[model samples]
Target: MPRIELKTKIRAKKEIVFDLARSIDLHKISTEHTDEQAVDGKTSGLIGAGEWVTWRAKHLGVYQNLTSRITEFKRPDFFADEMVKGAFKHFRHEHHFAEVDGKTLMTDFFDYTSPFGLLGVLADRLFLKNYMKGLLVKRNDTIKEFAESERWKEVLSS
Candidate 1:
């Protein structure tokens, strides 16, 4: 298994940053470059515990569909989602938020295990880890941008 951790600071409220992190609409916007779309289940609003979402996207020039469920949730603080079906053997992503010095501190912990045993390990070491990290970074950057500006109102209100 490989674990990727990232910390981002947003000049915004924790509540706003938290909501933005969980918003399905915001995710679609963040991944627009990848042509990611929510094709089923809670496609537009804040995803909560026990809720699942199925997303289709283009990654590495291939189209893939991944379904994940929110296994844990704590409003304005933390949440964790685990892959129910996808290319990986397993994957779990945890999002955490806190208020620090009047700013929001957002952290991501992503853990994943690839299939094909040793071959998969080699792939992870060669590229998958960095690729996954890049995706998370892009997503967090979008959240920071939206949370810090009035643009958030557009997604949150709808």
Candidate 2:
């Protein structure tokens, strides 16, 4: 499995950051470049534990669908989602938030395994890991951008 860890600092409350991180609408906005959309399950709003969402998106010039469920949740602190079905063999993404000196610190732990055995390992080593990291970074950037401005109100209120 390949793992990606990212930390982002947002000048906002922990609860606000946490909610933004779990917002389905914000996710779609962040990945707009990929034309991602939620086709089933909780397609919009804040996704809570035990909720599942199916998303269709274009990546690497191919359209793919991935379904994932939120397996764990703790308000303003932590949440985790695991893949139920996707191109990868398996994947898990965990989000953690903490308040430090009046700012929110958000962390992401993303682990994934690609399919196809040895070929998958080669792909991960060559570019998959970096590609995935880039996606996470982009997502975090969107979160930070919204959390730091009045834009979050639009996302949260929707």
Candidate 3:
């Protein structure tokens, strides 16, 4: 199993940051490689626990479909989502938020295992690990930008 954990502070209210953190729309905007469409559930508006969204996107130029379910949620604080169906052998990600000096401290924790057993482990070491990290870095950088941008103000009000 591989675990990736990342934390960063965003200058915004916890609720605002947390909401944007889970927004599929924001995700599509942030991840340049992902073209996501919400299906089988609320595509827009607020998302909460028990909601499920299906998305199709291009990852590494390969189109993939994934369905994720919100397994746990506490508004403005934390949420957890697990891949119901996807490419990976196992994938579960948790998002956490906290307030600090009027800023939001956001954390992402992901756990996954590769499909090919020892071969998968070796493959991860050779490419997937760094690739995944770079992917996450890109995602977080976009998140930081969005959280600090004027657009997020509109997010705050809504």
Candidate 4:
């Protein structure tokens, strides 16, 4: 398995950052570059424990569908979502939040195994790992942007 961990500080409350992290609508906006869409299962609003979502998106010149479910959750603190079905052999994404000096520290741990054995390893070494990290970074940047600006109300208030 390959793992990527990252931490981002946002000038917002943990609750706001947490809610923004789980907002399906905001996810769509963050991944617009990939044309990602939430096709089924809690396609909008906040996703909570036991909730699942199916996403369709274009990646690496191919369109794919992936479904994942929230396996664990603690409001304004942590959450884990694992892949239920996807091209990957397996994947689990954990989100953690902490309040530090009145700011929210958001952390991500992404662990995944690629398919096709040796071929997958080669791909990871070449570009897949960086690609995955880029996606997460982009998503976190979006979360930070929304949480720190009035733009949050556009996603959270509705």
Residue clash pairs of candidate 4: none
- After superposition, the stretches of candidate 4 with alpha carbons farther than 4 Å from their true spots are none
Q: Count clashes in each candidate, considering only residues at least 3 apart in sequence or on different chains.
A: 0, 0, 0, 0
Computed on alpha carbons, the lDDT of every model, listed in order, comes to: 0.94, 0.96, 0.79, 0.97
Best by TM-score: 4
Local error of candidate 2 at 77, Å? 0.2
**Ranking of predictions according to lDDT:** 4, 2, 1, 3
TM-score computed on alpha carbons, candidate 3: 0.88
Alpha-carbon RMSD of each model: 0.7, 0.6, 1.9, 0.5
Winner of 2 and 4 under lDDT: 4
TM-score of 1: 0.98
* Alpha carbon lDDT at 148, candidate 2: 94
Error of 2 at 78 (Å): 0.3
Question: Which is the winner by lDDT between candidate 2 and candidate 3?
Answer: 2
lDDT by residue (tens digit), candidate 4, 1-158: 89999999999989999999999999999999999999999999999999999999999999999999999999989999999999999999999999999899999999999999999999999999999999999999999999899999999998
Which residue ranges in model 2 land beyond 4 Å of their true spot?
Answer: none
Please, what is the TM-score per model? 0.98, 0.98, 0.88, 0.99
Q: Worst 10-residue stretch by lDDT in candidate 4?
A: 98-107
